[model samples]
Target: MEIDLAGYDGVIVSPGVPLNRHPIAAHARAAGVPVIGDIELFAQARSELPAHKVVGITGTNGKSTTTALIHHILKTAGVPTLMGGNIGLPILSRDPLPEGGVYVLELSSYQIDLTFSLDCDVAVLTNITPDHLDRYDGLEGYAASKARLFAMQSPDHVALVDFQAEADHAVLDMAPDGLGCLFLDDVPVEGQENWPALQGPHNRQNAACAIATCRILGLEDDAIEQGLRTYPGLPHRMERVAEKDGVLFVNDSKATNATATAPALAAYPLIHWILGGRPKTDDLDDCAPHFDHVVAGYTIGEAGPMFARILKDAGKTVTESGTLRQAVRDAAAAAKPGEVVMLSPACASFDQFTDYEARGEAFRAAVEAL
Candidate 1:
């Protein structure tokens, strides 16, 4: 099948399409048609919509949680809001938000590549890590794409960035006028222990970003605090599924790399960790600091044997379950009171499931069957 770009002004493609290698990119280039994505279309339509603001969040991890947190806080404060771009419904397909509405978008690097002029009222870079390297030139290229979010923002607009890592600093460097000056410490997020859904250092950072953005938008402390307390967490990312015989089950299937999975391991104690899918990294060095939390590890999917050996060598008890259902059964059977059976696979889900959501659903079903 051939796609003719005879009279088309541009070719719209999914963010997952790789412009560096895809045939559509070449065809579009040959036809002198600009290759764009939904985000770009949304950007072009913003002038015709009602009065609104946009918050754009992008990072290697934690962006979904942060995006949802902001939207939840806005809704709680009685502001009209919609979350899209990466975490929710398509931006263009949805109806125009009413006046004073905020569009909180979770952006990826690929989407950023195609979006030329999305001037967010509040732009956030959660954190930059080495993931999705195949889509860009290298880690630097990926970081640059994330930085473009801040670059697109007007100087009067707020840019909230996490300057924790060297790569994050690099992202700031690439941005216009070094806008990545805001830190989590700059804003005080008190009483985090009272927030049930937000736990661990990662969530704390996410909370800081949300709090900062809300404050910039004129939300008071009381409203932000209430929103934080009542905000329910998203699925496939540290969601509590069920409990049986005093053993809790957690689904963190969205932790598709070691950096994302490390915090989940640190959040709990006596964990019967079920991990392994299509391999991302050869070694789990980022997760090494939290290895003591694992009571035992169940290896499954494409990376099972290698992960089993790695865990064994680390002096941790290892079970080569090779499948999600078997791993859940073994972990559940072995888990005792006060222990957790958590699925925080630090790899892609293509080997055994359609996506991370499917993997998380399978974890829930297996837990329910018990």
Candidate 2:
């Protein structure tokens, strides 16, 4: 719906709204209304309020969990904080903060594209990967969009980067040379041993980024540790769905690409992996390194046959389970003791479901039935 924000403060929209390709951009431009994202709206509203802070997080993955962890830490320390943007409620929908509140925003590339003047107190880039490439022209264009978050900030802002790969390195290499960039590799990953939910190398990177962000925000070390220990992981993203008959069921439906799903595959061994959907890119070659972990593959959705062919050629056992329900049942039946039935579809969900959440729910329900 087109909003008449004339004389009103501003209009807040879902980060998924493609302003560059959507009518909202033209309408807002014609109305002289600055096309600000939810994060920008939150930043603007914070001005009239008491002393509040914002931590903006953007990356190809781990954004939701990192944002939640930051908010969890702040709340554990008795600081009022809200987690919003791509993680939870729309930023503008929340009631105004009273005083000394913190806003942890999980920003997507589209949101960052719309946001121009938002100066986050703590800005973070988890890692950049080949994602949403159709929206941008190529990988460089996509990285450029992610880079805009740090660019919009002032020299005083702090950036947490998880330089995962050469692509991430290339993105960080263009960081204006003098910006305050905290590399996750430089952070000590030792303290996170106490946090089980934050397991795996990806979560370690996430923990390091969150710790750096909280530390930059002046959060005490004790409080940060407490938050890390108590933080519950986000749903549908590396969530432990069920364990039946000695087999573990992992619902990493949020992994819509090879880079995102690769970490989960690396986390486990002997996986009866359920993958395939509306394929994101041409190849799953990035995930090939983890092929030793996959004992059998259950393919589903539009890319089922294609993935089956790919796996078959790779000498991996494969089944073209056309639906999520069938895929789950087949994988469950085929899985043995000490094996993992993981739903890490390295593709988008639009082929058979509204989104990844629905696809994940369907996987859970199917798993429950088995």
Candidate 3:
């Protein structure tokens, strides 16, 4: 990681690099070289690529789904599109799209912090919540980082923000005039019921944001609807893995935190909720409202005992299963007809698995085994 920063325009780093404390950032700063991310690199190269619109989506949760959904809609309408940024591939790694194409990017707050000049044609803020507190000053600082995506856009461009879950009005203030406010309830329930991948109130907002972004991109309603109906959905985020004897198995391993897991819990009525992992927060305050939806809880990984105690205190039946496989088996065995055996752990998978994707694959494998 040692290199002279002479004659370099800027040091490009991944979103995970904490510029606030990383020595690389300090070295780059001392060398008078700015540290930027892939999104900024893509912004600089935009003029070289053929005429194409960019959609930048940022928030604590649902950004990935919204980004993928928008990409799916554009493709469904026969428009050439590529999804990158914080989701799949780095923006600079992918081949440039042809004319009339759209680049849908799921930007994290960290990426947005390092990105300076990405003026997205359509920018969406799904919703803001407390996350990555160690990276920024606090929740306000984190929210400000997300707000920069819209601030980088032009006045003529469209900015879509989810007003329903917006914790700070200041984020809306940072948006350009003629802002498009998306409310989850505004998205017709009947329309969403048909979208299997996009279930739960949170996905409703994700769908709403995608719909607004697609409409701004000049997509017809029919094409947008078709895309919503046919979005295969991203892995580990509300993915319907399998079904056994009328019991559905869902893999929501990307939750990683209670804020992300809360919506997944709300998606199913009778859930044998399997949760826990490397602990992020001591309390599941965000998920408390949906306690009634859980038929019982199976806890595992580092936070197993803690979550078991919490669920028990909340008057919900709890199983202190110490492993993902055991939690799956316990939930599956206890699950009755018309119940959902969901793996929506509200913590990171580092305690037992390499990452959330690996945890999700394990959940899928465990369900397949059943």
Candidate 4:
């Protein structure tokens, strides 16, 4: 599938394309082709348009939602914006924007790896966690991949950082002193109480990041508030599916790791947690703190038995529901009033389904049948 990029101005590689492990990097470097990501393409293309801006977001979690939110805000304020990068559509596939447009890019570590000359007008790092360790050597290597987002930025650009945890502190410390980085922790999350869809501490941090980014972009205070209030959240991430017979069904299928799923468990008081798939990292140590919220644990997919054993040892009532359909049905039948039947699998979806979206759709269908 290798094509000659000698004639092309720049090679727009897919986010899934692992330049670090793939031959594309060597090919482009040898061909004298500027191997750029979709974000880079969008940033370069925006220069020709009048008053167009670029907002780049990268993190271990919340990257998709934050990018979508930023686009939603700008779009709400009568500014045209396009969202692409790791959240999917290749940036080159779309046409260049006109005046007053903003390009909101959801960047992954892989995409950042390919981009060399991108200087985002507003760059954001939500938070860094140990993810894609196989792609990188270890946690430090993984952290280094995330750091490239800020590292590639120019001194004049703004960096919005969610420095809420120690890991975030480490990433921030790596930045040059007096680099004009804005801390999302300093922003008041107390103000966005009216936005129901953006509840929970995780979303609060996301909101703060978006607010700081928008403010830096010179968005008026009233426009920022309006944008935050009207922004609709992305699906499959803390989405409220349905409420049947006093039981709330939440689809957090996007939580493919323990750290990502931990926030969902913290948001609910009583949860009949539907977890387990092809396991990612070893141990559910990050999720252990939220064990008190689990009323029962419904394990599914290949890792079902392993998860069941772990939950059983933790003294949580566990069921070995091998499939998502079975897990949903069993949880629905056993869940009591005022309990949440949450699908926060804490693992990747490749074991049984193509992706989290397929798993989530199965959960929805199963709930509808019940």
Best by TM-score: 3
Q: What TM-score would each prediction reach against the true structure?
A: 0.88, 0.82, 0.90, 0.85
Question: Candidate 4, 43: how far from true, in Å?
Answer: 3.0
Worst 10 residues of 2 by lDDT: 165-174
- Model 3: lDDT equals 0.87
Q: Write the per-residue lDDT of candidate 3 for residues 13-63, one digit (tens) a residue.
A: 878887888899878887999899888988998999999999989887788
Please state the error at residue 44 of candidate 3 in Å.
1.2
User: lDDT (CA) for every model shown?
Assistant: 0.89, 0.82, 0.87, 0.82
Q: Write the per-residue lDDT of candidate 2 for residues 198-308, one digit (tens) a residue.
A: 767789888988888888888889889998988767788878788899998989999998778888888787999999999988788889998988999999988889889
Give the higher-lDDT candidate: 1 or 2: 1
- C-alpha RMSD of each candidate structure in angstroms: 2.9, 3.9, 2.7, 3.4
Q: Candidate 1: where are CA atoms >4 Å away?
A: 1-9, 23-33, 165-170, 173-181
lDDT of 1 by residue, 74-149 (tens): 9999999999999888988788999999999999999999998999888888888787888888887888888888
Candidate 1 at 12: error in angstroms?
Answer: 2.8
What lDDT, from 0 to 1, does candidate 1 have? 0.89
Q: On lDDT, who's better, 1 or 3? A: 1
Candidate 1 colliding pairs, count: 0
